[model samples]
Target chain A: MICGRTPDELIRDIEGFHGFVAPGLVIGAFMVDLAREHIGQNTEADAVVETRHCLPDAVQILTPCTVGNGWLKIADLDKFALTLYDRHTFAGFRVWLDLNKAKAHPNVYNWFMGLVSKKDLPKEILIPAIFDAGRDILSVKPVTVRAEFAKREKKSKIAVCPACNEAYAAAQGTPCLACQGKDYYHTGS
Target chain B: MICGRTPDELIRDIEGFHGFVAPGLVIGAFMVDLAREHIGQNTEADAVVETRHCLPDAVQILTPCTVGNGWLKIADLDKFALTLYDRHTFAGFRVWLDLNKAKAHPNVYNWFMGLVSKKDLPKEILIPAIFDAGRDILSVKPVTVRAEFAKREKKSKIAVCPACNEAYAAAQGTPCLACQGKDYYHTGS
Candidate 1:
């Protein structure tokens, strides 16, 4: 149960951010709710989102994390999952959509099971069904993150390109490949 | 110059997909142009994009690669950069935004410089100026990718949850975590 927002209010907030509300948003909200329960009041946490999907939005909404802020890292595993790790303790929790529990909602279950292959089902039918399924269709488990990954990455050295006079990662080698020539293939050769 | 579409037309297409036009799209287009010039009809190539930003859109538009098709990999280095890798040969090229060259355009230069300073500028003035800076602010380099990254990742084994009858990655544990219980924290314990 989300503390302050009703399901309709949550959907509206998600829609405000994502331009539309869908099953992923509802599922993400539930996962974030679980994460919040475990990670109580530690706002300095970082999120490692395993997919480039709706879950990141939930993390951003529920936590003080953002890609621009470098607190959110997208792992792009394409699994509907995410991990919230405390930078100080390196303790974290991984949350995933529970395919088993998803079966209780026929629309979501069929989609996950590949029984219904349609990509563009009407939102009117899909959104409500997914929101109703809610917390029942998720798994949250505690995990520990490696210390190196939990810490913020150091900024790389920036250098000016002689030809273009633009800053680039000096570690990649300079004269800057793009400024040396337009032919991309010949640069490494 | 982009071959078929005029600059206005290209911007329109980018705007249609991205909802707004900005400098990142222009840089992405130029990168795609360089990548296309090298790869040349090898539709089997994969794109390894270094950022989760505008470059993916350009790759999706100009090439056969896409996240859904598993041909586009987001490296998430958070630099405005990308690499196009040939799946068959492991040949690739990298492109990055040239921050120094971006300075030739006063508006863009000041913005980039101020960006590091953390001054909040309004978007209306910022977006068009960055767009105007365009193709001049990029660096392209050819390189070879390691064989391992070029190869497609193996699909993980799937198992059905006994409680809900839906499939999940069995390696994480059985009965599936969500089916075991609702308490996310204690599930691991």
Candidate 2:
């Protein structure tokens, strides 16, 4: 079982939430479950998803952490890992699939290492293999969130951009992001 | 039509990728299409997604830019907007739903303003309203990406964290993120 449900059941839920059963979601379920086991159920927790892909969706489905709620932050460091910590204490567990250990599990390694393309992936075999290997292929490290990173930024003052006539964070100052040279389009001549 | 596909056709594709037809995706479809029309075809492009939600998926579906390719960057500034630019010139269009204009379309206004909860949303009505409103509720601005922001960060040197025995960007300096107190868990006593 993965995330307290059988792999089949979990896949259905993941499909409903993530559109398709991403291998990252399947693997992330194991990582999340392992971290939660270490943290226990009584404390308030927050998450730091280290990537922007399917792993963030896994955290959203398995934990209270979500992008909209500000409890989850996607750092996009390009690591297929995450940390779940006590909101009050800023103490948490970091979990990642250990590539070295995954070598023993060819299916997991193949997917993680990009040995097979998505269209050619054998999902039927991959799902069960992931469930069987479970957290055996993961690495966990205890960590404390940095003080500077833990503190939430206060709401900044708002200002209207002179160029676009739209409101923006006054802290960014002057014109607005579009006018400040971060625009994505040029006005047609 | 949204993104050169009929609403029904687009919805099916979106369902396969994003799980559901989010109103933001529907609105973002109009926003992305408008931006594309301004930029025209046959140009190398990159995108900066101002938020970390459905809009990025819309860009991924409609454009060649994607996070994996470093062509799309999700800034997560909490704005429901995006910028698509010429890769070489960094000149592009900024597109966002104008709240003031949205007031005329109740469904669009309700969703953007959070006047109704997701479970209670009327998808049958909302999808049509978005198509009818199209780019009418959107505001566009021509922008040039700031030189600093446009440049990609070079791959930094790698170092092993003394504390955690894990690899991290050497540029972050000493110990690594988990060792530097950016950790999410504390070691058990």
Candidate 3:
């Protein structure tokens, strides 16, 4: 109905060319599927379908990083493997193994996500959150402490050297003699 | 004028209390500096700040995805260093390195950014496109060969099946049909 070829025919073709004929590369299969489905037939929802071209291997794609074995290497698609992308789409058929075969890798617990800077330049993108599997369970955060912050008991008023202790309250515009000493250094800039 | 204390005084106090004084650990000195300027002072803006708290040659806060003195090790920051979360006071510091390190480590990347099929979840976050200084480069993408759509320049078609000698049609997938049958793969797929 969609492309003159019924879903059965399409499935047969896929079984023959993609499943039976094609080698292990997902890109080509995905491209063919995309060209047929989205670009050709336009049967599926636009947002869910993605057609990626000239994409690097997962390990290669994640360059400037230090992990390995990023690809979903397999002899066939039956390997309920590969996350983050559609199973049938070649564009989504990504592998994460290290092409280098040396060092190794995960995402959630280890990765740093999108960047939002003050020095603006380009358009912004919507990025989802990530979490790795089996290896790490803790979450990455800013500066959290292991202990809770409890109120400190108040102490009697004492003078702290402005030269060494930046915490002390100082007189307005008054220079302390501690700062005048040879090794004196200012604490509260 | 601005909170009465000079920036220099604060810097000294920070240095004195760092490591030698605090001992257990705090964020890196540079990260602390960033936090002070971006978090400690800008209280009117974002509400929170946290960090993985890893430093160099000292107490290592080995959490999930921590960032350390990468710029210092790679090269000095000459007014421009890649900072991933220097602006987001709530997200924490070391975003630049944490993100890059995620590229290097997917378990952590996944732990922090992986998305899985679920209900009522916050949604998945596949963090492949990280910051390149600022640009969103897919650090996880693999090595790709640039292809041309408009022109067919190079030795265009792949060689025919070596065993069968049949002019391989585009229909047969990668690693030529001849090879697959004979256990020899081609680039077709």
Candidate 4:
């Protein structure tokens, strides 16, 4: 069971949290389970997810770490892996799917290698393959978070933006980021 | 209306998607509405969210850009701002709360300024303040996305990690990121 939930329970949670049951979410459950096992189950943890995909939802569902709480960080490195570390000590485990090991499971290997697109690879088959392979396809390792990452950032001084007069982190400098041109909306017709 | 949804509809969507109606999500609705209005309603777009907070959900709900689709880029600058740009030309708009404008609405100013913590700030008062102020509190500006950000990235060649035998982005080098030391799990006893 991942996150102390039965397969049925986990599926319901995923459907509710992610709006669907994704393959990455299933695999991520195993990855998270392995990491939590190596670390003490009850340890307060911070998570760094390596992709912007389904894995982030898995971490959010199974642990206290979440994007909103700032306990979870999305590195978006495009790797399907995650690290769960102690909040205070910065010690943790990095877990990822071992591609070589996956070779033993043809269905998983095909999906992981992207030899077949998800549309072509039937979910009925893929989901079972994922469950059959489970944690057998993962690799876990001990790691100490780098010093820079370990340091907790103090809240920045709030300043009024001269341009829009909005409050913003003063560290971003002058007139605020939107006014400085790192913005996304354009009102000029 | 935000995303063509009435306030009640938007709130229901927020509850379903985020499991709650966060104050930021409510404010984000107005921010997105103002951007979409300026950028044209039907334009194909990409988004860059400046925070990992409630604003990302607002963009996801209102626009086609989503974290899963590679269209929404989370810069996590910790600013409560977002930018929506044309997918092809990378020309777009940036929208942020105008702190000065918010000053006209006392409840919004207090909440935006964090003069009172959420625990002390009543949601009944805060929610109505956000709705009353709405698009009136936003500032929208034209922007051209930087060249580096505009370039569409090609899929990376996959390589085998020698240490864990996992398939990883070849550019990350030899043993893969986990073996290279930027890992989060600790399996060592």
TM-score, one value per model = 0.54, 0.62, 0.17, 0.76
What C-alpha root-mean-square deviation, in Å, does candidate 1 show against the real structure?
9.1
Candidate 2 lDDT by residue in tens digits, B54-109: 77778766776654345677774546788888878888888887867988998777
lDDT of 1 by residue, A1-189 (tens): 462579868877666555466466677888877776776664456787765556666765556565434577766344577787777776778877887677688887765555654565566777777767777888777876666555676655656667656555566576754555432233462
Question: What TM-score should be assigned to candidate 3?
Answer: 0.17
Q: A35-77 in candidate 3: lDDT tens per residue?
A: 2342223222111111111111211111111111111111221
lDDT of 4 by residue, A24-140 (tens): 899999899999998888888888888777787788778766565467777645688888888888888988887778889988888878788878889989988998999998888
Local distance difference test values of all predictions, in order: 0.64, 0.73, 0.23, 0.78
**Candidate 3's error at B73, in angstroms?**
31
- Candidate 1 chain B worst ten-residue window by lDDT: B180-189
Per-residue lDDT, model 1, residue A7, is 84
Question: In terms of docking quality, how is candidate 4 classified?
Answer: acceptable
Worst 10 residues of 4 chain B by lDDT: B180-189
Model 4 C-alpha lDDT per residue in residues B89-142, reported as the tens digit of each score: 888888878777888998888887778877877998899888889888888888
Candidate 3 docking quality: incorrect, acceptable, medium or high:
incorrect
Model no. 2, DockQ: 0.14
Residue-wise C-alpha lDDT for candidate 3, range B81-135, written one tens digit per residue? 1122212222222212234443464432333332222242222222111111112
The clash number for model 4 is: 17
Q: Given candidate 3, what's the lDDT at residue B128?
A: 16
